[model samples]
Target chain A: MASVYIPTPLRKFTNNTAKVEIQASNVDEVLSNLVSQFPDMKKHLYTSDGKIPSFINIFVDDEDIRNLQEGATDLSDRSVVSIVPAIAGGVDFSKEELARYNRHIIIPEFGMEAQRKLKASKVLVIGSGGLGSPMLLYLAAAGIGTIGIVDFDVVDDSNLQRQVLYGVKEVGTPKVESAKKRLTELNPHITIKTYNEMFTSANALDIVKEYDIVADGTDNFQTRYLVNDACVLLGKPNVYASIFQFEGQVSVFNYLDENGERGPNYRDLYAYPPPPGLVPSCAEGGVLGVLPGIIGSIQALEVIKVASGVGDVLSGRFFTFDALTFQTRTLNFRKNPNNPISGEKPTITGLIDYEEFCGLKAEKQVKEITADELHQWMIEGRDFQLIDVREPYEYDIVNIGAELIPLSDLPYETDKISKDKKVVVHCKMGGRSKKGIMELEAKFGFDNLYNLKGGVIEYVSNYDPEASIY
Target chain B: MPVSNVSPDCKEVRFEIASRDFLVAERLAEKDNLELTGIYHTHLIDSAYPSETDRMSAFPNFSYLIISLPNLRFSEMRFWRLNSNNQFEEEVFEILN
Candidate 1:
């Protein structure tokens, strides 16, 4: 006798019995017997053509009958049968989008279903700079239903080197405006929303709530942290990429997988931001022209994978590419136990001023002497300990006869300086020198230390133009 | 037979018998000195087939009977049983007048 398990929706036909046993040799006989006992159920199970409906799936002995000989599959005396209906997620695609995404629709893994999911998704891209240029272009081309661009800067002539979204004609135009015009022209099927304002903590949540995923292409720690925190709070996946002179990094953060487990977030990779001005911005450090294109395209790929539900995403993993060495590496990372978002309760509830959070804001009041004032002091033969906190190579390039004490060795070489003499410190610019004065004042308790405002670069430009600029 | 109550865990598109209801049914079957051979429920709109949630929460070693009520009125019913791997299979039954 073959046994069958009835689902909740079909129990009414069997006198409220959940199961029954009957004599049957195959799936066809079992279904035939089912219809014989409850004739009305036949209409619901089969189409007018007498064929089984696509939504109705029959399993024989835990295996889908479709994988077997289907209705003709022979069943043993002890075989069990189950009638299961396919579950459908509500995603629809118009004929136009289907035609537009025909290439994606034809792929086996990413067919019409995945293309529908892509058209149902919304993605937010932060910045219209180097990385955002390519990221937004590809996402739009791939038929992301809605794309939000956050940028406040106008297209500059220097940005044309890597920000490929704009040309010489767009030099003075705002980036979001130019990006919207270009992306709309690329795919008029998608909706492009531009935020012509800075992505700040005050509006991060409001903007992020409307998007399904966020792609961080901004070039600063403040905006990066703000975006990350907002996404983490809103439970959105953050596709992150950053480009430096010759290297780039890409990762997906705060993504919740199918199993209801969250992957590592940005904070897990970088526990905290680097000290302000410690890592120079792209403007200060420089970047290869084509690096953002490569990294940002990868970011777009990850976003598409996430939206379409095709291919494995880069969740909990970090990828690095060095264009100079032509090397690539992928490293796996786990959620940090100490990370605020890891434990049962997260610590970060709302956004804060990221500039102050990353220590970019000046906290202490320090005395400063400008280049002209320092020049006057030098000419008047001022008795003071002039210390140069810039690197030896930079000092070699040009110097104002100040004593050389690189910032890295300042702590160890503190004994060489006289605590009684008035001290002035300088770096390439005023940033590092200000740091040096702060360290001297806090660590060594040097009360007379003063920061040489505008450092050697400013001094040379103002005091002596003949000095070669490094 | 009438459905006494809908499962508290029932969603708009999915349904499940509450654990407490299952316990009560088991207790009643035990008190009546009857072997708990099968369970049954009703569907108001969908076809007479198990949903994914039903498969996930199905009990092994028992028959499952489902009643389909297309318009809040009894229409049809069928019986099923679970196999060794927990997948359901339909079983034949008859009512003798």
Candidate 2:
């Protein structure tokens, strides 16, 4: 006798009973006995052709019947037969899709079936920047059914170095919009969903819930943590990739294996975010233009592998690429015993303010004014010393008539700063200016200091568009 | 129509029941000249609310009844309707003795 576990939706057929013990030697006999006891459930479980609907899945114990012999799967006397209905999306390839995926169709492992799976899978990309450019392009080209892009940044001339998705003509266009347009041109068979907004905790879960997989190409730790947590909660695989300078890393996080066990998640590798300012962004720390191209392409490959269920994914393994040294390494990692999610129940069930978690949203320690405000103050002849905390090379590229005193030399150059008058600090972006102010106030005890918001780029964009500096 | 047991699958969400039992119930209802009113299911762990999977599989015109069995013991039951926005909205119902 095998015990057939009735799913919640089918329990009514068994007089609201949760489980029914029936005499059966195999899956077919078990299902037959169940139907003999309750007939109406037959239509929902099997079609008129006496075949199980595509939406229905039967599992003998922990293994799916499809993985075994559908109805002829031998069942033990104590085997628990579970009948489950399929979730939302299923593969249905059109004629054009079949033609478009003909190359994949002939492959031994990735045939028409895998191509159909690819067409059914939905992937969400967290950024449309350097890594995102190649990721979105390759994903769309591979015939992924749906692709969602989250980006709030506009195309900048500086992005032309590595972000191949956008050209100089799109310098001021929104990244998501430009990415959609470019990806559409690449593969019109796929659907491209654009989210021209920041990926924040408030919208991460809502947006991530609709996708089957999340590809993290974000350049910041805050968004990376947010994507990782959201994927873990939703039980979605997160194909993650990060590139800095000439180095890149790729891994698949929070993936469930055939044994019903989850692989090591992002928290396993990084228990906590690095301290703010310790890791400079690509904007502050320049990267090789081709670094993201290599990393993001690998991310796309991982996404396809996970989606099509073709090759062994990078789950539980960390892969690194060093373009400078031309060396690659793959390291294996197990589920951390101390991980919060390693237990039966996860401690972190929802997304948190990642910026705050990463310590990027520290309390304001310095007064700041926007570029427009500074421009007005300058026009009014405000007596303030404009100090540029950026490096000398950056100063040579662009300057707003502010005296250069690089952040590294700020301690020694305290006397160069005005002590009597109000002092204004500006850097490439506003980050270094805030740091400069804090250092100046801590060491030199300068009380009257205001950091220019949006830094030099903002000022150049708004006040002086002719400035040929990034 | 009513749904009874929900078995967890390693991959994908699936719902199942015996078709013979449901057909017999439908025939009995037809003999009584009673139209099929709704479908019912049980929730063993979570609240007696329709999940996202339920919303996706819901029939808009039919009532969705969810019985709560917190620890495999009968608890409470609620009726839901599929609203226009494709969300499940609980409906007020009276249980006759």
Candidate 3:
């Protein structure tokens, strides 16, 4: 008796069995016994001519039957007969391409067909910041044929930690240019097209039209909504992933299923963006260094799957990760009836001014004083309360005689702030202090607050350049 | 749920062959001075075909029997045996008066 070992993908026809024994003395008889036992498998195991396809190799105890006596190869008692099928091949991947992506190609779930599709697809990435930074690196490494990067801002020294795509040398350079250079160094086969401009309504449609898919990594709400609407209008799939502090979210929108029925868009999930400053930006909230590495990599994976036509994508569903608790959840969603772009009775025909749409139109300018003015105030010995709204950790690093009242503790401890005195509130770079001052004006009605223009950094830079920042 | 699931018009039904139940049955068979032979289950909306799920739960050498009650068609009862190589083969059985 010879034991035939059946591989997966064919197990459904074998009654979900892994091994089947046959009372056969030769390879030919063993196959006959197999098909007789599992009649449904005969169609899959053989060609239309009743002959085994060349892709299926029959082996008798580590020896192929073709290398032995062909089908007449005698099988010893208890011999293990294995039937192996070609998982991926047939000019589906080029010689060099296969060598580079051999590990990815071997996965039966993401085989050569998907690899070929990946090599033929183009994806546009918006804002190569935190989410875009890591996502672009993986996409370029994964062999996406062409990638378009759209960003008008230059790189800053602060982006080096989590934005793994940029190095210390790339600071003060255009993000799109640095990103393209770094990506090409990783894989030269794929083309990297850089659009050194804002992905606004003007160029959004034109740039998005060139790519089959768009990856939304923009940090601001206006651009996030802009990218979502543009992809919807262009009939392109948008892969959105955002990280805030220790938490991150990923979703696929405007994606078409097999039947051409489009999935939900961003508006379906949230018809309107949260009022400005309701959700603190990554710049203000601060993120764990490794959080984007995990979230953005998943974003990269989704783009590969969505573009290459493999794996179940995150369409019509939202996936979230909480690094603090190390928990992940996927919430399934559907199209909304009020989605302005894809829903019933569409209102937005094309891209409009997203600033007004996000309620950032009525900009409120807080009172401010520059570092030079503050120095003159110190020279004249101005009597004012210098309140440092930054955290104690930052205050401990460097402080010039300002009482530390961290913004987090301000809501509960607002009584400590003097309303009678002239208040000069300041933060590390004035953003947080501005927010603290706004909270004071809104809730406490203390209109005596004035934000330091460049905050402590500028004050330190103007007087003492040797004052090192922690 | 039997109360209200009817999209397919097939009247859905779920089945489970718990391990604890099997263990209790094995002990009962041992106490009765009988050998544990096989197991059986009813398929309310299916035929007497050996499903992959059914075959996977059976012992390699034990017999399996399915009693199907497909309401529209006549009820059927068939016997099966899981061979040494884990493959299933039908075994003949007859009802007697």
Candidate 4:
């Protein structure tokens, strides 16, 4: 007698019984008897070609039955034929989707399989900024099955310059909500999930693990590094891009090759970050308005290629572009032996303080005061100086009766700031004011500066909804 | 299966069992020469009568027993099933000695 032990997955077919003793002398007889007792188990145990598939391993007495003479393997009275389903369907596209992707299907190299793979892919885009705007537009247009957007910033008139995902109506609204509204209007078929929160170390892994791949559109170096480490640790490919004044760089990081070997990651290219103030941000060093659109489209193409095995993914190759001279270059880079994440002797295990690693002082370097707190202070007749570090045009639109000293003119007008009193500085939103505080503290050695948290936008949104907000 | 309060409705909760688990339950029932006939649940705020949501989400041809606990001192039990027109029709019951 041979005992067939059914795993949990196939137990339903066996009337929820774990083991069934069969009167069989060989491996084939044991399987046939088990299937005979439960007729539904035949298709689960055998392929259409009447052969056992590789995924389902058949073992007898801790030995592979295939190691013996296949079906003729002898089974003793004490033999246990274990049917184990180890740890770990047709999604046909609608007629409209088929028509939309007819161009892709027409290509012999890029056919229905690639289209299906694309429709099954779930890509998480980190930021809804300049790059995110164009990339998400194309992603939705192409009908990626699921797209996740992570952004916390509210839309402003400044974003309309390059952030094609929003309009005047979306101003003062969360970027994710705005992007979702725009992308949905573009293609209602694909699913778009919004994370109206910062993608920090605490929630980075939680969010990235849900998506099949990540297309990083984050602007800051802190988030760029965070995206890289999360993708590497999760063994997911990162479709990466970064844009400067008129130049942009694109590369696919931590990608697995056909042989299941990992390609060079972000650390392999630039092992360490440049000093905090060394590389100015896109906000400070303006991006050529159309640079992200061009680069972001390329990024979307790489993401689609990675999701669907259609063409050669830009995994090992780094592409750079300069709009001034219209120059384009593609260079090859390899894994660095000195890399900390993936090296002969690895050091870092999990995500660490990216701000400190980038040589920026950990956050809270600049003291901040919220609008509600400031309003309470004003009501109590608290003695404090409020400085508006915004352009005169913005101050003209609306102001909380603070002296206007544009950021460009802050250095020349430092004498106007009160040294004895606690100084609260603010701009359109909290970002520029934070930079203004950091600049004054570093250059002029002023210690009494406090950035107005969320700046005028928060003040108007929560405290004074009637007030005009940029 | 026990119910949870994750759903939007605070007054009621239903265990949305997976089809796989339902299939397993059916198979287990068949092994003992029985069948899955019905489900019973509780309503905290409303009476034992079926709510509109309950009728819309109900599976056909199964007796549904709803026990209402409107207050700490009183309790009521009623039986129901969906008719051919997909309306909840109350079923009369008897107590055995």
Model 4 stretches with alpha carbons more than 4 Å out: A1-91, A362-470, B1-97
Better of 2 and 3 by lDDT: 2
Cα lDDT tens digits for candidate 3, A186-287:
998899999999888888898999999999988889998899999988899999999989999999999998889898989998989998889988899999
Q: What is the lDDT for A350 in model 1?
A: 82
lDDT of 2 by residue, A144-258 (tens): 9999999999999999999999999899999999899999898889999989999998988899999999999998899888888888888999999998898999999998777
What would the per-residue lDDT of candidate 1 be over residues A1-470, giving only the tens digit for each residue?
Answer: 78876554455567777567867898888888888887866865778998887656777766788789998999888787866543221114434554677687667577655776777799999998999999998999999999999999999999989999999999999999999999999998889999999999888999999999999999999888888889988999999999899999999999988898888888888868998889888999999989999999999999999898788999999999999899999999988877765545667778888999899887887889899999999899989989998888898999999999999899999997778878888888889888887888899988888888888999999978999997
Better of 1 and 2 by TM-score: 1
Q: After superposition, how far is residue A222 of candidate 3 from its true place, in Å?
A: 0.4
Worst 10 residues of 4 chain A by lDDT: A84-93
Kindly report the interface RMSD of candidate 1, rounded to 1 decimal.
11.8
| Quality class of the docking in candidate 2, CAPRI style | incorrect
Which pairs of residues collide in model 4?
none
On a 0 to 1 DockQ scale, where is model 4? 0.01
Query: Measured by C-alpha RMSD in angstroms, how accurate is candidate 1?
Result: 18.4
Second chain TM-score per prediction?
Answer: 0.72, 0.76, 0.69, 0.73
Tell me how each candidate scores on DockQ against the true complex.
0.03, 0.03, 0.02, 0.01
TM-score for every candidate vs. truth? Answer: 0.51, 0.51, 0.49, 0.51
